[model samples]
Target: MTAASLEGAALTSSPALGVIALGLPAAVLLLAVIWARPGAGAAVRAAASLAVLGAGFALTALALRPAGPSAGPPITPTATLPPATCSPDGGLLRVAASGFAFDPDCLAAHAGEPFRIAFVNEDAGVQHNVAVYEDAAGTRARFVGDPVTGPGTTIYRVGALDAGTYLFRCDLHPQQMRGVLVVA
Candidate 1:
């Protein structure tokens, strides 16, 4: 993964959002209590409370801001696709991931030969990948490709496999993005 990918992880992942959303109010409240003294006048205490609320709002806004151009390298999806080499029976396969589901939700490839696939991730700024498992349970991997943050497309070079059906899914969201890979 690239540096931008690591940075994008926070925006796409839920844990980061949870921290900023929940932690901010707690922090703001703590500061309000510490800054507002019991001996202070009613007007002063009210001003401090308002200030704390404003600070929390501002901080949350900054935290939720989308990553800018300078955040890191950009991996934008492109129209150009990589070339593939395979038998006429099973050659290049195009697969796209979007809305946490794989289009077609099924794949086919020629067995006992090298396989090539053009994997495109349509979910912008969200990480997704096509992984071939030994079974539908995804207990094992026949081929696993590096995840790409979309919208972008990458190639997955899988080793030769015996003719059989295999499981394919997004490791990041296995339950949501999944399919079947049929090798013949």
Candidate 2:
């Protein structure tokens, strides 16, 4: 993944938000305890500090614990198209990924057409995903496939789009893998 993507995901994740919530109050309480002196009440001040520290620790633990495997929205695995050398109409358009480069290097497909993109993750110790963008403009908003993880397969129905060229690539390994889709 790109540095920006990794940072974005980290920032948006729940644990990061929890850290912020836990930190702000702990900091405020610590400052207040240090500055507000109860004259000749050293024991009471120490007790209050300990209580604040314990509460902060508890909050941190609660934030870090996973919500279990089935916590959020269910991810229904997308259908996997069988390995094939050519398109349904006998046109060759399959891209194979091994060693970071997508075989076939490029492809073409009609708009509103159902085509199959076979993504194979051949590199050991490597994880990958393919994202099919609607047009050549690689904006985040218009995309068909939601980055299919590799060492796997996924079938992408080429959604209808204006007559133009579209692009596809591994979001995790962009420069090493890329392909095109021609929508007539």
Clashes in model 2: which pairs?
none
**Root-mean-square deviation of every model:** 11.5, 11.6
Please give, for residues 98-119, the per-residue lDDT of candidate 1 as tens digits.
Answer: 7766776777888788888899
TM-scores of all models? 0.56, 0.43
Residue 44, model 2: Cα distance from true site in angstroms = 25
lDDT value, residue 175 of candidate 1: 64
Q: How far is candidate 2 from the true structure (C-alpha RMSD, Å)?
A: 11.6
- Candidate 2 residue runs with Cα over 4 Å from true position: 1-93, 134-137, 144-150
Could you give me the TM-score of model 2 versus the true structure?
Answer: 0.43
- The backbone clash count of each candidate, in order, is 0, 0
Alpha carbon lDDT of residue 14, candidate 1? 70
- lDDT, candidate 2, 1-66, per-residue tens: 355544434455667676767586766778596659757377777777777777776765555554
Using TM-score, give the best candidate's number: 1
lDDT of 1 at 43: 80
